[model samples]
Target: MSALAAARAARAAGRVALTVPQLLAARAAKQPEHVAVTQGSGTLDLAAWQRRTQAVAAGLRAAGIRPGDRVALVYGARDWIAYAAAYTGVLAAGAVAVPLSTRNAAAELDFMLRHSGAAAVLHGPDGVVPAVPIPLVWDPAVVAALPDAEPLPGPGPADPAQILYTSGTTGRPKGVTAVHANLTHGCRLDPPLRRLAHSRQFLHAFPIGTNAGQTMLLNALDAHAGMLATARFAAAHFARLIATHQVGSVFVVPAMAIELLHSGALAEHDTSCVRLFGSTAAALPPAIAAGLAAALPQATIVNYYTSTEAAPTQTSMVFHPDRPGALGKATGGGELRILAVDGTPCPPDTVGEVWLRAAGAARSYHDDPDATRQVFRDGWTRMGDVGRLDADGYLYLADRESDVIKSGADKVSTVAVEAALHEHPDIADAAVLGLPDPVLGSVPAAVLVAARPLTLAEMRAFLTSRLAAHEQPSRLAHVTALPRNAGGKVVKHQLRALFDRPDQEGTP
Candidate 1:
């Protein structure tokens, strides 16, 4: 057996229960003095972090939080340590955690608070206070004042852990309910500090409320080394942190990767310490992946594909020249398949709905049974994305099933068109959508942010070799930026609205 596989098996054999609080307690007991997480100038050792989280849990209990009650966490990225403590504290108190982004506006936050039936809110100083009728607003000071005490009994694996609200792209955001087992999947009772023995530090700039951010938090506890993160993402700042901290592993979304590549900050910093750079949230554009590989010759670039609902069922790929756009094969015991419209398996290279079944426990959307029924069926979850699997089982995503542009009779993938546009040196960002057309019923249109002026004809000429005539965009709009959500995904509905306006035309 492989050494890593053997180690994982050994660790799994020793595990009792897979719960966040138990994992934190295990790490603290095993590696009391190890630095767990660092944000800016502040750092916490495992022992201190555990004590603080327990104290926060006591505080929440004192404030009348009970088992199964939802507690909302609203914190900026810089306040991640507090956020982490509150997240664990909520779970430790046997209450469900509802992590909301500080990027959310008042109305959206209000809606989430009301929808989740949150009893209390734990917020950072800089977080926007929602106008909702939540009972308690606990901040850092309140948590600190609470006497340090052993928390209430840790929740069982089957108990609810957190409610993560999805980024509303197509419609209202749905809360994805995750159990303790779902959150703590793959955690093991192996030697606590063994995971990061060779690795220096793990770094990321994902905001506090994201799935990526929560994963990073888990890494902080379970990984072998210290964890570092920034509250706000600036490419130069992120680059500087990596150089300053000598981070060995880094995680980022594709947008952050693009910004860092263009910022020219890598040239100014000594980044030789970085060995692994990983991208998630969305597929790394093949051109961007190549650029990253060229820029960080010492590092291995990896791409991970998964959704909030179907996590731990990730498809991971280490970048290789032969598989330029492939999102590698499913790993970690997850199963992946492409299904046609008729719900049968699609042949290799045929675009169809992507479905994933996690190796661990299944998940469902909270309070939205209709949405749950639509995506989760039997043991599998529909990823709501359209893609194809290669003969070798590598995944290639086309576009979101809802975002696919229907032009005449041809179903054009917006992501494919955007990928082709991104291949052009002058285009910085791109979003493609289907616009209503009197003659064609619907025609593919593009909105782009470019480094230089571009004409529709120039774009079409460039894409002629890369795409078919029907796949080429029928109209184009130039904008300084494409609308993006907190998760860095393009809001294509907004793009469609922008392009459908009266003044906007086919030529830039």
Candidate 2:
């Protein structure tokens, strides 16, 4: 059957068939030759992607994989096209896809493989192979040579589809599993609300296997424009893609934005095509957001707030000069609520725990019932963020609950402290953490990447108008740059070790 007919049959299969393969078929039917995904020098069109994934699915099953069996995919952003094929192939084969990043260490890779009990590991192109024993460990590139088997039995809305592990910002990562229903919720072929429709391409450099990267992969299969990615994220390459492709939208984390501004790439490149700039993974600090606005004068700055556990359901804020502090409000059938310690909704603008509920089946930690129970209740997931909603329902985050620091009698939000630091004339990036204090038990510490060495007295004076007396950093350390992981979050544990060393101590 032709791609169109396959899509029609897929639609006929269920009232609202939300399977990934069905979505792929549907897109091919709509625009077969459109560039679906683009990386450094690689590109895949919709028609070719559908055809390749079908063969790939057959090849995996021929290799002895089974329905509902777990298959780990270890591909990076550089291998996006191949990764896309392998990822969709696993889903088409009716097996759950457990995607791992090549950026992960061998030890980390082995842990996820053993934890998920992955039946096979598809290390396509240049994916990292864990040391664990597996029945099959093969490159998915071999799928191109295989004759297609009978079409997969097809998936249902409730069929287990994907397993994505959390970014280990705080501790060891956990496997977050979801069904097709959860993955495809709110995804429509003809989305009533269209964004960046006038542009032919959109760009990003989010790593594969990350929630952000996975979202872009889905965008390639479903969005109006082709998805553009690069092997590595450099301010110069990112701006060049926007100019070369006349890309209409861009997505990034705050770290990239800071680097883009610091590197002055936006000023050097002709990136006049972008109309929307969206930041996710973490909130964009206000200072950085303003820098982007000045640099991309025509683009509307948008901030996306979501987590691996709370995806699809998120708040997307269109930056308004009036609400610089506001992150976003819930959109797309997503419900956001801030609850006090007593489990009641906190009044608007009152700080409390954040809970998010997306529109479909809830996700759970694979084989981790206790961990699942901790975050997923009824249908809502705890965001583990301390934040508040304004009268207009805009979210303003204070800090991660785990990062809050107590100084003497007051609880200081490290995020708030860091925000103040970002506004300082000399500081380019900052991370606020808690360190031991003789009197306060714990006090705020500042790790800085400043233009010049700054004494503790200067920092305190600069923060006087912006931060509370107790919120200011009690211990300060200067570093050429803050250590960040691939996803762009400061490695806090590593940052803390600096305080123990006497040499890089706060300036006397």
Candidate 3:
């Protein structure tokens, strides 16, 4: 049988619990002595991890955490061990785990906590404690001192397991409710994730709170794998960890992969031990894809195109250097459809919205039935991505259905920041566009027609007072007139190309 057939067959195996804690319990029983999690100097075996998870559950229970309650997990990326224990403990207590991004400032953090209706929050070393109002805070020191916890009774398949938040572009972020069944049906896990479990070790580089980071943790646990923890992704130290730990896999965004390719450190490190290098969260340029393939000939460069609402929808494993725009075929996890604006299926290579459907697709966005109604339909999850599928079944991403600005790892909402900037009295009109940056990924370049002679520094100061750190513009360009087409809408694409030219100044 083919890979898709096998995935479908395994998915039909019936009623597997998909909760984070539940997966850990299953792994513990199946591979008790296997290495579960790791950092630079420490490692936790499955038994030890199970014990810690139990202890965390008990502690959470003692602190009055109940089932259906939302508990936030705010930690740095390298704290995967703590994340595993805390996440399972929350689930064991019959509560939902809502992971928080460490990069978020106090304002954004507070907003997300309140928006998610989070009753409790667990913070690692990097989180702001005073910003959250949850009753109990799960800290790293507490995790280290606590004794192992006992396994709690199962809630079966119907209980709520986790609530992953959508990328907050409009208003506040909506919680994506996921049941125990979603995990298994969403993505297929192979035996190599179990048989060569010890051989698999992940390098925690991305933000541990995002969907991508959560997927990495789930992937590692699925493989019964270990990890090398790091708080921040230093290109130098990250390369060192791969060589030292003999890490077999690493999950990086496309921008990071490109940066590593140009970092000059790829030649210095022995990265042959890395067998799987996964890239996601954005489109992979064919040229850059080829360069990475040439650099790491030993590793399989897998390109995954998905999102918070519909993840792992399509994957491209084989990269052909000759093809400029080739994203490999769809996986069994979801059905990919290129549809026209009227919801009609488009012809091959015709640009349209990439619609997806699978048994593992998210049911609805919690609390926002209207939004849930918009994105989720007759068993299909509209991925909000604009792309085309070729006759060969490979997808070619063109642009986004939503106006979310993706700069490297940062997903900035153009509407959100534009709203903030328009409030400034000195600013007459403001148009924000993403400029391609070689180092920090994508940076926002503001093209403004000020009411008077307003300096870029002055405009930035006004935004800094209101906007989050990453949302602020890295560069600002003063324009005499705003470029508008016949429709009166600003031509952001024209402004975007200005940042690409080396002729522009004030680029970071």
The candidate, 1 or 2, that scores higher on TM-score is: 2
Give me the displacement of residue 378 in model 1, in angstroms.
2.3
Q: For this target, which candidate reaches the highest TM-score against the unseen true structure? A: 2
Global lDDT of model 3: 0.68
lDDT of each: 0.83, 0.84, 0.68
Better of 2 and 3 by TM-score: 2
Q: After superposing candidate 2, which stretches have Cα over 4 Å from the reference?
A: 1-14, 148-150, 190-195
**Residue-by-residue lDDT tens digits, candidate 3, 194-247:** 522424677656666667776766665666456556666556777888898887
- List runs of model 1 lying over 4 Å from the truth: 1-16, 191-198, 500-508
In Å, residue 401's CA in model 2 sits off its true spot by 0.8
Judge candidate 3 at residue 395 and give its lDDT.
80
For 326-442, candidate 2 gives per-residue lDDT tens digits of 888788788889999888999998999999887777888999999889899889999999999998888999899889897789999988888789888788888999988778888
Each candidate's clash count: 3, 0, 9
Q: Indicate the worst ten consecutive residues by lDDT in candidate 3.
A: 1-10
